[model samples]
Every structure is written in structure tokens, then in C-alpha cells.
Target: MRVGLYPGTFDPVTLGHIDIIERGLALVDRLVIGVAINRDKGPLFDLEERVAMIERECAAITARCGGEIVVHPFENLLIDCAREVGANVIVRGLRAVADFEYEFQMVGMNRALDASIETVFLMADARRQAIASKLVKEIARLGGDVSKFVPPMVKNELLKKFA
Candidate 1:
């Protein structure tokens, strides 16, 4: 079925993420949004909250784009998560050269672990390239408007969290 896994913490799904998912869907029949359960990062949003947020955002995209989007949470190795999701490809969003460097190492490590699964990188839309979850949370915590970075629902959640 050509399933693909797109893994991230997604503490708060940003417009940049939506852009990647929308584009990534074109390459695979089912795109699984793997929400990484990284306790080390101490995300602003809990795993359930992040999953719900991604579900909401992806639902809208699915309605319009006519593709299957599933949100899955995992704490194990990304390749293992891909295996669990029955994904043969891993999708990633690249914002800049810095992102590419990190992703390069990850792709190498993942390939070493499992050569059957492939990693695909989609460049973020130029306008949304600078938008990042960390920056979005920082702006929201500092009382700055994050409407441009995240959806209204996510923006509201961020405000409520910091309030």
C-alpha cells in the first residue's frame, strides 16, 4: 500500500509540518504521522495532546487532499516505529542546510539499521521554512501572536498552556 512514516515530536504542529505532510502524501498511499514520545525534550504539549492536534490538522488536510493520514505515537527507534506502522519509507521535512545535515546522519543510521526502508525529504515551502515548533512555543510564551506559524486551534492551545 506504500505506507510512509513521518516522525517528529510535534509538540505543536506547525504550518511547516502541514506543508510537508500534504506534499509527502503525494509519494505514499498512507502517510503515518509518527509523534515521537521523547521525554528528554520535555515537550510543551503532552503526547496525547500532540496526537490530537495532529489528528485535527491532518483530518482537514485529508478531507481536501483525498489521502489517508494517521497519527501514531512512538518512543522506540524511528525505524522501529516505521516497522510498526508498516511503512517502507520515512518522510521528513527539510527547512535548510542545517536540517539537511542532521537528517543526513539520521538517514544513514536508519539505513544501517534497516536497508529495506527508505527516507524521503521534502523541502518546506519557502514562506513556511522559518517556522519551527520551538520558535512558535517561544513566541507564544512571550505573548507574541503565532497565528502565522500554527493553526488557530493550536495557537489557542499554546496560549492556554502558557496562561
Candidate 2:
């Protein structure tokens, strides 16, 4: 069974993230969405909130994709999280040249940590490539409608947060 780990802060799950999860599911028997507690990123939502939001959003996608989707929240190193979940492959979504360059370096370091684990990169869909969590937060903060960028639940949460 090929298990893939897709790790991200997912402060609030966005459409672009769902796109990657759907695409990543195609290559592995099971795709685990590892929601990491990235202190460096200063997430707007708490760990539990992020986990609940992702679980709520991904339920349908997991059913329709014909594969298992596990939304697990973790702490510490990503490589350690992958190992804990028994993931042999790591799924990364590359939005542009800069993303590729950054991911390339991370993959090298991951490989050095564990040669047995492999990294897979999927290009973001053109429509959603520009969507990012930080931008979504900024737009919401400034009273812009982010209903299209994020799930309805997240949009509501963002509104309440700003309200």
C-alpha cells in the first residue's frame, strides 16, 4: 500500500489545497493530510480548529476519490510526522518556479534524513495556483469576499474572526 504524506500548516483549508489533495490521491492508495503546527508561520487558527476544518472539508473528496484520506495533526519535524504515519511518499504541490526551487531543497534534506521516503511534486491547477492561505487571510481582513478561495465554513470563521 502506497501511503503519501501531504503536510502543510493549512491555517484554514483553501480550494487550492483541496485540489492538491484530490490530485495527490490519484498516485497513492492512501493520502494523509498532515496538518503541522508551524509556529514560524503564526497560524490564525488553532491546531484543533484547523484539523476540524480540514476534516469537514475533505470528507466528500475522500469518498468520491475512491481512496482513503486521513487528516492528522502533528508536531515537530515533518520527516518524523511522515514516519509516524508510515508514509513512503511525500506529496508537495508546486505553484511556480519559486515553489519548485524551495521544494527541491526540502526534498534533498528529507532524502538525507530518510532515503526510503520519496517526494512527489504535483503542479497546481492554473485556476487555483494563485490561491494561498496568507492572501486569503489578508483579503478577509480587509473586508474582501474570500468565499471563492476558501470553503464556506472557513469564510464564515474568517468573518467571525475579523468581526
Q: Estimate each model's TM-score.
A: 0.98, 0.96
Query: For each candidate, what is the lDDT?
Result: 0.95, 0.92
Q: Which stretches of model 2 miss by more than 4 angstroms?
A: none
lDDT of 1: 0.95
Question: For residues 1-163, could you state the per-residue lDDT of candidate 2 as single tens digits?
Answer: 9999999999889999999999999999999999998888889999998999999878978778778899988887889999999999999998889898889999999999999999999989999989989999999999999998998898999999899
**Candidate 1: which stretches are off by over 4 Å?**
none
Mind sharing the TM-score for model 1?
A: 0.98
Model 2, position 116, has a per-residue lDDT of 96
In model 1, residue pairs whose N, Cα or C atoms come closer than 3 Å (at least 3 residues apart or on different chains), thus clashing, are: none
Worst 10 residues of 2 by lDDT: 57-66
